[model samples]
Target: MNLKIVVTNGINNLIKEDYIYSTDLDFILLKFISNDWGDLCNEDKKFQNELLKNPNSKYEYRFMGVYLINNIKVWIISEYNYSIKSLIMTILLPEEY
Candidate 1:
């Protein structure tokens, strides 16, 4: 996927609360989307559907997933803005969301 990614200001606040560096969030999102590991698994499909339901709504639309990037476990919650063609992602602890 060649989608553009933007991290929202709210995500910065969450990062600080989560004790995660902004750079790590950028790296993980880039790596995950750039890599073509395989077709979407069932879990991914479910998440995608959830994300698409109200992607353009005023309220944030979130889809949660766990990803391993550079041997680190990353919990991600993201919203896709179809109008702008971007994915806005936040890195959170699995228990945070």
Candidate 2:
């Protein structure tokens, strides 16, 4: 998708501390990119879709997805960063939000 992805130190440490396989996280991110939005409710899905409609909105909007990674619930947020002029996605646990 040619997007810039980042991770938080909290999640980074969890990945290492819990021994979560990278492949599993990669697969979850794939689902996020595909708009699976795994565990999001109907209202949340609608909000995500609304943001997607704003490719030209004055303010940058974000697309968020929640999914299970290695049996742990996680959130993947993708947003357009006006400063960088690119899509930025972040992988983090709910607490990290």
Output the lDDT of residue 10, model 1.
Answer: 49
**What is the lDDT for 66 in model 2?**
84
Q: Once model 2 is optimally superposed onto the true structure by TM-score, how far is the C-alpha of residue 80 displaced, in angstroms? A: 0.6
Task: Indicate the worst ten consecutive residues by lDDT in candidate 2.
Answer: 51-60
Which candidate should be chosen as best, given TM-score against the real structure? 2
lDDT of 2: 0.77
Q: Write the per-residue lDDT of candidate 1 for residues 1-97, one digit (tens) a residue.
A: 2244544554556566765566767666665454321234677756666655674532355555566544445565566676776666566554455
| Overall local distance difference test of candidate 1 | 0.55
The digit string of per-residue lDDT tens for model 2 on 1-97 reads: 2478898886788777975666777988888877778899999987877766765532466677887766788888887776777788998888988
List per-candidate RMSD values in Å: 7.4, 2.6
Q: 28, model 2: CA deviation in Å?
A: 1.2
Question: Candidate 1, which ten residues in sequence have the lowest lDDT sum?
Answer: 31-40
